[model samples]
Target: MLARLTIFVLILMLLAIGWKAWAYRKSALSALRKVEVISERFTRTDFFEEDNRRWIDSGERPDVVFMGASITSRWNPEGKLGDLAVAQRGVGGQWPSHYLLRFRSDVVDLHPRAVVFKACAITFRPGVNDKGTRRAILDLTAEAEEAGIKPVLATCVPVREDGNTVYGSDGKKLPDGINDRMLPFNDWLRTLAAERGYPVIDFYRAMADDRGFLPADLAVDDIHPNDRGYEVMTATAKPILETLLGAGRG
Candidate 1:
């Protein structure tokens, strides 16, 4: 009886948290809508392109490079990937197409021993489909290979379906359909990695719950993860990075 009561109370508490989060919904929605607007009107190719060129021309070779969208942009693995020179080439709200466009300037020119491409979480965005995302990644990887950079892939972190205002679990079937698209992307990447004998770091499994949602505790809102979530992400990614770099060196 006590255990059941505890479970019941916990559920109630979560519901309450969800309710409180609802109050902030409109603002978050506005911010996200603005992001999508910006994405549609802009390309971030100019954001840090010249900086990467300077680094390359200076002859400073980073040991590893990470490329992706917001998550990759926000991740600071310098301390976690310790002692190894790391490069971050993440652009906020970018999709695979954006990354592909800037690949040579941001990544290949860096002459990284390996590149870890973190998939973005825009599988639900309009005009963006799973097949396109898949193709972009494949194109990026192929380009990386032709440039002689080791291509390492990573799955995106989970989304807190309830925490995010965009698709919160507000008495609705919330984010399932959006995330339904996510699963296939992940599955395809994993299968492709295995088939090609490439390294894949599974950040999705690290931050996801049994039911596949980003556990509320690990996420900040809906799509972005909190420090604890990124902590796990970095930990999960480190060994794979180590192995990839090690193998590439030999």
Candidate 2:
């Protein structure tokens, strides 16, 4: 009777161990699935399909189409840019490559006279493919030119300093090196615009503090802009856009 009781206790311990292992595996798999979802976000090319379709069905072409990732998504340029008809085609959490994928459908197909191209600040994060980002932007500019759409390049807005760290859209803390990279990237954008002979919106200059960081008053977070920030951006973009659209007719 004593031996049998000992065996029963051992069996129960074994069962508990097995159950704990299974639970841990299940939890790890759930976390992996979430990561997979994030990895596949760049492939979401159809994000604006229905919106594009609706605009096409309306038989009205916009004067300008603002295309970019989250920052542009939050920007409401309609009725804010004077009398020009505007359409916002900004998709959140997209890379420049993803922008190229939908450029034709969203920008060229919409038949806008001008298109504003702004890349997300996240594209400059560490370990991302910066070369691919550059290629995609160039391709977008070339495509727009071929289709007779004026392409205006805008600099990525500066990220804000949060305490001792800078946080990104993913809620992860970004390295200080990201700011180091962004300045050069924006400089490259300005050079590209000059070489290509198109207008460039200097959002960085318009919103950056004396130290080159986005001040708290204009920032929604590390990378996004608040209403006041957007107002600053709009004020910066207004003259450049007016000049570009006016030049096309002139």
lDDT tens digits by residue: candidate 2, 29-145: 999998777655655656778988988999888888898889998999776677777888888877788888778888898899999999877777655677888888899999999
Model 1 off-target regions past 4 Å?
A: 1-41, 163-176, 247-250
Give the backbone clash total of model 2. 0
lDDT of each: 0.79, 0.83
- Mark the regions of model 2 whose C-alpha exceeds 4 Å error after superposition: 1-41, 163-176, 247-250
Model 1: weakest 10-residue lDDT segment is 163-172
Best by TM-score: 2
CA error at residue 237 for candidate 2, angstroms: 1.1
Clashes of each: 0, 0
lDDT of 2: 0.83
Backbone clashes in model 2, listed as residue pairs? none
